[model samples]
Target: MKLLVVGATGTLGRQIVRRALDEGHEVQCLVRSFQRGAFLREWGAQLLRGNLCAPQTLPPALEGVEAVIDAATARPTDAIDQVDWDGKVNLIKAAKAAGVNRYVFISILGAEKYPDVPLMNIKHCTEKFLAESGLDYTILKPCGFLQGLIGQYAIPILEKQGIWVMNGAAPIAYMNTQDIARFAIAALDNPDTVKRSFPLAGSRAWDSNEIIRLCERLTGQDARVSRMPLGLLRTVKKILTYFQWGWNVADRLAFTEVVVGSEAIIAPMDEVYETFHIDSGEITTVEEYLGEYFSRIMKKLRELDYDREKASKKKLPF
Candidate 1:
């Protein structure tokens, strides 16, 4: 069966495309740009160019597609009205119009339960719609992405301040992007996964302090992570991002709950991981994950430094 992957160029989407290809499924990748789709094309995916806002643009993209995987995202405000709510709405409508079945949607854990979080709330609304859409659908609500932590904040913090920073020592379940991709591929291949929503995470939870300690041990640097006060952290984030984004807002609230309010009992990491098969007593440990993650980050940093050196040399007025 042919599968269509939206947002094929994104961090998690790329992994999903790779896993689907490895499983011998024919893949059609929908990307916003042709250039960005080259990698997917290289991996034997039929790359289609289209924007998510227009339903007509997607039908042709979904032509001859049996299943559609929506791995796309946008800003919360934009996503709630567009991707999560309306984009999914359009995808279902288009999938039906194009006669496609088995729609696999990637979401986040705590969506239904954490409706106070704007993005999760949008996803909750979208999930409600998806359940009512009358389509063979599988919704994957993965826990916090491990890759995002490493790339979005850790490496930069390590390089600049030689540490990872956070508001409080709260243990949260996290999952590798690769594992999430593998699970999605399995769900897509197995008919049993249809009409189900699975929450995924690592086998264990690690707090910010523990994670930084692991990184310190791996990198051979006694990098120390200084805890930022919740109020101060929020102020810094607001200033740095110019109040445009708030992925950190949830963390602040969680920290406040633990500090000023009740000690929130986060679900057992094993339970969440079990749903994704990572907690079934077979998965990488935190040490192993951190080792691999740090090695990759170091390699990327080296490459970036080398590229900068070469660029600087070329620009020299000799």
Candidate 2:
């Protein structure tokens, strides 16, 4: 399969490209800057310089592509209308013009339910455009990523011995980005996956308390768990917004609210496993992921210390 991956430089996009390459597919990445995407050349991906916000740059990227996986997203500095909605609409038009066979889109869970939210609203609008574009499509509505949670909360626990959680004991499942890549690839050829949408999640759900307990057990490190009120987060978001430095914090807070407040966002583990023929046991759990992550950091630090000691033992050139 000859595949074109938009947002190929992004976290999930890069994972999708890697998985596609491992499967022996020819991959091309549409990137805005060649310098940032120089590594893609080494990874065997053909780079097509383009920006999602600029529709004129897409036709060349879409040419000769059999399928497209759109993983592009709006950054904190970007408005949802320009990058998320209009950008995707442009890509869809180009893909259709190029006679692309399949279009795979990565969308967040609860998009339709959160129409008032800027980002979610844009995603919902893009999904609608793809559905009516008269092209074969697959929409993946995945839950919060495990890697994201680890980056946001796990490191704080390891370094500061504490983590903040909203809505005590509220459970949320975190999906792996690699699993999402697998599903996206599967959609390219699976007849059943065409024009179908999937709500994805991890094997199990964990609340803040469970997360802290698992971290302590895995790393053998004790950390304090602080429960935060939803109202407090809302207030903080308002303050940050007033200062015009709150987009990132506001996005996180909004997502946290969804995770803590909604039961519908949780994907049924058994249903996902059975329907997709996936074994949840094979997926990386939050505890396992954190253990490996912290171990790597410790190992790197030890290597750096050893290098410093070796340098100090050498005689000075003077």
Candidate 3:
């Protein structure tokens, strides 16, 4: 089967690409930057240059592809609509025109109830569209990506003083990106997972403190877990909002709601395990994930430091 993976360079998308390739499927990745996807070319994936925001780039990417998997990331509010909702519509249309059959999407868990929340709302809308489109579809609503805990959050803490700062004591159901990719590839390959929204997650749940404790066990460091006050965090958020910079106030507000409204959003790991018939033991525990992640980041930092030291020695009063 010829499968086209959108956002193939992203965290979840990359894993999906690898898993699809491992399953012996011919893969094509729709990437915005040729330079960024150059590495994938060596991995035997046909790299097609395209942007999701640009509909003109869709037809060529969809041409001759039998299946589609979307792991695209989007901002909470309008951006989510723009990407997940609007961009998906474009892709569906193009896929229909190209005579493609299967479509698999990566969504967040609890999207069904939190249609008021920007992120979940957009996913819900997109999911609705996909279901109504008469296309063979499988939707995987995953929990907080374990990869984000490593790539997005933990790397910053490791660079700093081993401080993991979070908003509250909210519990999150997290899952490995590898598992997500595997599920997505399974949906693409098997006919059974179609027209269903599988809630994907790990074997357990953890709050910020518990996560920190596990991190400590992994790195053998008493990592300090700091909680930011809501009022103060909101004030800083509003200030950043005024500047309209990375993660603006609206984004912060939405995230604050997501974190504080955890009771409504959080799902049980057993739910996902039941749907996929996957053993909970097969999933990576928080400790296992942290150990592997920390080692990789340490290697990266060492290489970076070595390069800096060498460059510093070569500087001759330029």
Q: In terms of lDDT, which candidate is strongest?
A: 2
Best by TM-score: 2
What are the per-residue Cα lDDT tens digits for candidate 2 across 1-318? 999999888889998999999999999999988899888878999999998888899888888899999999977677667888889999999899989999999998878987656678788888999999999999988877888867557787668656777764357678778888888887888877788778877767877777777777765678876778888877876676665566666765665566677363577656655656777788877777777887897788789999999999999889
lDDT of each: 0.71, 0.82, 0.76
lDDT score, candidate 3, position 227: 62
- Counting clashing residue pairs in each candidate, in order, gives 1, 0, 0
TM-score of every model versus the real structure? 0.78, 0.87, 0.83
lDDT of 3 by residue, 5-56 (tens): 9989888888888888888999999987889988777888999988777889
Q: Where does model 2 exceed 4 Å of error? A: 224-226, 238-253, 262-264, 269-277, 295-318
User: TM-score for model 1?
Assistant: 0.78
Off by over 4 Å in 3: 75-78, 151-153, 160-164, 233-249, 264-277, 295-318
Evaluation by TM-score, superior candidate among 2 and 3: 2
Clash pairs (backbone) in predicted model 3: none
